[model samples]
Target: MLEVTGLHVAYGGIQAVRSITFHVNEGETVALIGANGAGKTTTLKAISRVVNAVGGDVHFCGEKIIGVAPHEIIRKGIALVPEGRGVFPRLSVLENLRMGAFVRDDKAGIAADIDRMYAYFPRLKERADQLAGTLSGGEQQMLAIGRALMSRPKMLLLDEPSMGLAPIMVQKIFEVIRNVAAAGMTILLIEQNAKLALESSQRAYVMESGEITLNGESAALLHDPKVKAAYLGE
Candidate 1:
């Protein structure tokens, strides 16, 4: 479970995220959907401590994690798959996955998780020894998600898993996400595709110009006139 209250983030003098509050329950997939510059990615970065929050609080599993170091955040059971699929381009697919488990020393468990990742992403298995940079965009995204899963995280922060991919590949990526959620992974997803995000998540938040503007059950948000007009392109 995760809770973020009155969160604020800034870069130098630019205020990026303002007073964003939301929660994701255990085994639930909560989505933050918005247009570019809406601060969805910044909010996730603040939650993961990749970028520090200037104000407010973040709690994970009942403890305040606002100031925790990024690596410590992982140790506490949260993993972030950032926007742009920040995979180690030079590393082999297998090696990239290995790096994901860097915070852990469970050799047997890590290896088993690698196998599980392969199951979730068969393309990765085929490219096990290949350089990650040489893979297609969609494959790289899959690798990013698989790498995050390697950490055996209690919750996943996914930022734009469908970005820059073809329609079929995006469908594949969302299918994997749905399967992961079905298997009880708690996910906080930041996505530009509002329809997909709302459809896949239990609850949703809409952000505009650095703040949360609307939030509710995803199904209800999907039909709201404003959401349909602005995000669903109706």
Candidate 2:
């Protein structure tokens, strides 16, 4: 459903992603795993148009979307749940979700989606009127993913969803991601927790210094010698 080919991005003279290529098929979960500053986040930002690619192509469902505005990209059925959860601190849980659907005009559908999100994350329902900043870190992450789902996206770009959470909470977050993918949403996940990310995804890619260094089925990569030693604590 999404294709990135020969993609490149730079921060002034510092090139972060260099001619990277990958794709996420419909209803499939793919992961990008790397250490700090490996360009995993930059790749997602480029796909979401938060950062412009210096060269290469981004196509979603056969349409070129490289230069599209971030909002437009969201409208085209792609939503990004960035690292740090990026929620509006002062906004109520319900209000933050409403912001997610700002690009849509279907009031009834939006209402239904809000209800669905509440069902998906019961905690959000309990804190429906609470300020987002007051929620616990795990709750805030759930809110971020739930807010992205409010847009009813066909594909989700998740960046570091497991960062800073307790182990149990990280497990819960991955469970939600699995359920979301099972419900037919394509996902391109960038995660620092390589072991969890690989275990959770169907296929995975490893990146280093802005380039794809490895790509394979998740299970295979999980047992790969280098992967085991470097990421799996082998």
Candidate 3:
């Protein structure tokens, strides 16, 4: 449901992404796996219009989104759960979730989605009145994902969702990701944890030095010798 072609992103004179191309079909979980400085995050930011693309085309549901404003992009059914779990620290968990539906006007639908979020994340429900900054790392990550889902997006862009959590928390997070994909959520994931990304996604792309180096089925890439050596540390 999303397509990015010949994407080139830069900041001033420094180019962060170069001629990158990829796509995520309807109901598919696609992963962009790479090390630090590999432009994985930049590609997602470019697609979401969080950063401008110097050259390229980003189309979502057949509509061009490269020039669209970030808020407009969210309204168009794409929501990004950025790297580092950017939560509103001072706001209560409930308040932060309510903010996710800020672009909508349907009170009943928004309230229903909030209930769904609470169901999806019971910990969030328990801490509804607690300040977001006071939650644990795993709890905060859950809050972030729950908040994004409140927007009722057709496609979700998750950047390093497994970052900074304990191993058990990571597993729990991936289980939620698997359930989301199973329920037909179109997801484009940027993950430094190649193993988790490949395990959770149907298809995967490897990026290096700001360009796509390999793209294929996640299982095949999982066993590929080169991918194993470079990213999986096999």
Candidate 4:
């Protein structure tokens, strides 16, 4: 449902993402994995229109979205849960969730979706009135994913969902991701945890120094000697 072709993004004179191409099919989870400076995040930003692409096109549901405004992208059936779990620190958890549904006007549906999010992450319901900033890192990550789901997007873009969490917390987060994918959410996940990324996704791409170097079925990549050596530490 999402297609990125020959995407290029450069910061002044420095190129962060070269001409990279990949895609996520409907109801599929595709992972982009690589080292810290491999341009995985930049590729996501370009698709989300948070950063302008210097070349190539991004088509979502068959419409070109490379020119879509950052704010408007959310309305076009795409939601991004950024790397840092960008939550509204000053707002309470409930209020933060409310902000997520600002794009929609279905009061009853919005209320129901909020309840569903709470179900997805009961910790959020427990902190309904707590300030978002004060939550633990894991809680914030949960909040970020919940908030993004409020938009009811056809596709979810996740960036570094395991960046700073403990192992148990990561497990909890991926559990929800598995549930979401099972529920038919098309997800484009950028994860630093290569093992988890490959294991969670059905298909995968490996990036190095701003280019795609390898890609295949996630299960197949898991046993690839190069992938094992470079990403799995095996």
- Candidate achieving the largest TM-score: 4
| Tens-digit lDDT string for candidate 3 (83-184) | 988899999999999999988889999999888888878888999999999999998898899888888899999999999999999988888888888989
For model 4, state the Cα shift of residue 135 in Å: 0.3
TM-score of each: 0.98, 0.98, 0.97, 0.99
* Residue pairs in candidate 3 whose N, alpha carbon or C atoms collide under 3 angstroms: none
Ranking by TM-score: 4, 1, 2, 3
- Screening candidate 2 with a backbone cut-off below 3 angstroms (N, C-alpha, C), the clashing residue pairs are none
CA RMSD, predictions in order: 0.8, 0.8, 0.9, 0.6
Q: Any idea how many clashes model 1 has?
A: 0
Please give, for residues 1-234, the per-residue lDDT of candidate 1 as tens digits. 799999999999989998888999999999999999999999989998999999999999999999898889999999999999999999999999999999889999999999999999999999999999999999999999999999999999999999999999999999999999999999999999999999999999999999899999999999999999999999
Error of 4 at 78 (Å): 0.6
Cα distance off (Å), candidate 4, residue 133: 0.3
User: What TM-score, to 2 decimals, does candidate 3 have?
Assistant: 0.97
Q: All models: lDDT?
A: 0.95, 0.94, 0.92, 0.95
Poorest lDDT segment (10 consecutive residues) of candidate 4: 14-23
User: What TM-score does candidate 4 get on C-alpha atoms?
Assistant: 0.99
